[model samples]
Target: MTTPSGDPTDHEHWRRPADLEPGQPAPRPAAPAAPETPGYQGPPPTTPATTGWRPPTVVNPMAPRQLPSQDQDSIDADERGARTLTYGIAMVGGAVLVIVICLLCSRVLF
Candidate 1:
């Protein structure tokens, strides 16, 4: 682990078995030169009309804006009768607590 001229088996700092020979590849660097005003050419003739977020030519009041058909069937029949009266009062309070725990275990074993 020492090779700044201090030899630890330095082939210029190691990894030498004659420099690889089973696949090939190692050479890629050349892609940077595209700046001639590459986009947006729609509105800037001294900014006179629509600038600063112009997405509403007619209707875009922060769009998700859609509820105008009879108040969506009266709020979908009031959220489907409030989820069917909360699952019919939790199945009639689980069948009246299983018939009051089977009449309190048949009067505590008669």
Candidate 2:
């Protein structure tokens, strides 16, 4: 690469070793000047507020209850009667199924 001629007038053409020619005087390096201090004094201002969108709030209406309160004795008797009827129906059905299975098994074996 070619060295720069270091001419003040030919500033545009200068590239580098950045070194001066042998007989030329070395130029003193200039101290960099500081940037000017900013004059901003306060916090930045905010934009005006505006309401955009809102969802509606709602309550569910309750259904009317029409059941009447009854005596404790009557309620207990009703529950017992229901359970007894269920057990009786289950026993009768199971007995009929067992009898039918036994009859089928005997006929097949014979």
Candidate 3:
């Protein structure tokens, strides 16, 4: 492949080297000055009046608690009903899938 007229490796193509004299070094620019500002003072401290307000109490999740006897019976009954419903749906879906497979097989045979 042919090389371009302006080769990057050639020092004459560089801006800094071409501008500076052979013996003299380039002059350094002055550092920027920081702006003057007053020290930061945070917002004034506040103390809320306790006339009627009260902080919320925290509950311990690990603590063992007892449920009312009637509520426990109701919960057990609900779980049983849900399990019966899930089993009934699964059985109905399986029967439908079997019937569809038999119909397809019969059609192919005939």
RMSD of each: 15.3, 18.9, 12.3
TM-score of 3: 0.40
Task: Decide which is better by TM-score, 1 or 2.
Answer: 2
1-110: candidate 3 lDDT, tens digit per residue: 65558766875534575578877888898888888888988889899788988777797468667975678888999999999999999999999999999999999999
* lDDT score at residue 48, model 3, on the 0-100 scale: 77
Error of 3 at 48 (Å): 31
Ranking by lDDT: 3, 2, 1
Per-residue CA lDDT of candidate 1, range 6-81, in tens? 6557566434345556565544668888778858778756846656766548854775768766787889999999
- Residue 100 error for model 2, in Å? 0.4
RMSD over all Cα atoms, model 3? 12.3
- How many collisions per candidate? 0, 0, 0
Model 2 — which ten-residue stretch has the worst lDDT?
Answer: 11-20
Question: Could you estimate the TM-score for every candidate?
Answer: 0.25, 0.39, 0.40
lDDT of each: 0.78, 0.83, 0.84
Pick by lDDT: which candidate is best?
3
Q: Model 3: residues >4 Å from true position, as ranges?
A: 1-6, 9-70
For candidate 2, lDDT tens digit of each residue in 1-71? 87476665775654434577766776777989989998987888888656875566597678988898779
Count of clashing pairs, candidate 1: 0
- Model 1: how far residue 81 lies from native, Å: 2.5
